[model samples]
Target: MFIRTENPQTFIKFYPVTVAILVLQIAIWTIYLLPLPSVQMWSNLMTGFNLGIAKGEWWRFLTPIFIHASFSHLLFNSFSLFLFAPALERMLGKVRFFLIYIGSGLVGNIGTYLIMPLEYMHVGSSGAIFGLFGVYVYMVLFRTDLIDRANSQILLTILVISLLMTLINQQVNMIAHIFGLFGGLAFAPLLLNKKSDGF
Candidate 1:
């Protein structure tokens, strides 16, 4: 019943943070889709441009995840969040979820910035999504009962496919994806619940 419901409130109650992020992405994209020529400027302000960071415009470290370069990029990220984020939110609860999401995203962006050319620009929620995947992998290992065997296999399969895709695609920022995952793994030990001792 929970999986197939028409009630928006049900979704909000169980997946508040996920729903909020989805709404934020949609609102941003709505602006991106507008006819005004100024719309392109959003990316300029939001993208993770190393040059901007070097100049002490440090917010670029976190803002890039909200800016998507293409419709397909946004679509895939939205789908990934809608499909996986709610379960992760439930697994880690609200505070840990928030911390892990942002922390991993920062790590991903920092990793990319260190290696990527200064003039290069990167945008999209892929790093945060990878963080979600990383957190889920940790859950599978330490919080097994929360995720059944089927979901564990599915998560593992997703991680493998994502890694392969990162390797094969030259345009993709493998640094962000790889480090985002590692960042999540590292956070799990400190943030993930080891027992029923409250997350």
Candidate 2:
């Protein structure tokens, strides 16, 4: 529910929105790729839902999206963004795309903080990535003609596979993924341009 197509001129002007996020991620990784003296790189600066929240670090909720656990983690999520985010920007306008991206990820973090084991620390953009998938699925269901039917089906399959794989991987934060999906469903109302029932 996060985006509506805008004028081509606006799209061109805002195209850098997605690029800016990518650049920030890359820049952070570039400087903090290796572990430091006490911080273990910049992770202490960036964490998902963790005991840090209890410590009164409220920023913990949204900060983890930028603190990826490993190169592969960042790589896959970044590639996914590269594939999905650009189209979303074009469709929903850059501002709305950002709303969906960050908002869904925040929901995932909140879910992890309240529901998951406090000892486990999560770090990655997978939650946000799943949120993007949720939006795409919603589009396929209600706005089928707005996107390619076949591609939508393919993306859905990919989502399922990713979920199943995560189930097998103990390191992945399944709680965050699930919450992010719910976030997408909840956010659908804002994505729509019409006055009709958002569902």
Candidate 3:
């Protein structure tokens, strides 16, 4: 399910939302890498700073979903989205997928703001990517019609590995990963209740 079978032309046309998100992430990361002071300042401003959120900079929650701490961070998330997101986008349609994507990220950031120390700060789309995992989990467990047994098993294995990695990776925001996952599970039923188009 995670494989990229679609060629560039078809992928762009079929999964515009996923493509757009990948483009936005890369563009923002590119600007963030610039040596200019203004770019650095802007990048700093966009991170998920718990103190900044407490200071009423609420946009930090949303903006951090697109920002990454390093080229590897951006590339990993972008590649994950490129490979895995298109299926959900195809199944859920553009609008609902976008809502889940952003909403899950917000849930992660808000959870971080509420739980983390005021001095804490973070950036990356791991929360959002994990949110996608949650959605797939929901499918594996409840919405069996959406995914076959073989694919479900594969997803479960990946999910286990992912959670293990999240725990092992000291740099990752554990709260955001956990919260974003629940966020996706929380959003799944409501969003998936309606009939979705099969990919």
List the pairs of residues colliding in candidate 1. none
Query: Taking the tens digit of each residue's C-alpha lDDT, what string does model 1 give over 27-126?
Result: 8988888887687776578889999999998999999877787888888888888887776677678989888888988999999889888997898788
* Tens-place lDDT digits, model 2, residues 36-131: 665553567577647879888889898888777778888988887776777676677667778888988999999999888777688777788788
TM-score: the better of candidates 1 and 3? 3
Give the least accurate 10-residue stretch of model 2, judged by summed lDDT. Answer: 190-199
Model 3 agreement with the true structure over 32-100: per-residue lDDT tens digits: 767899998998889899999899999999999998888887887888788779999988889999999
lDDT of 1: 0.81
Write down the TM-score of every candidate: 0.89, 0.84, 0.96
**Which segments of model 3 are wrong by more than 4 Å?**
197-199
Residue pairs with backbone atoms closer than 3 Å in model 2 (clashes): 1-191, 2-191, 3-92, 4-92
In candidate 1, stretches whose alpha carbon ends up further than 4 angstroms from where it belongs are 1-7, 142-146, 196-199
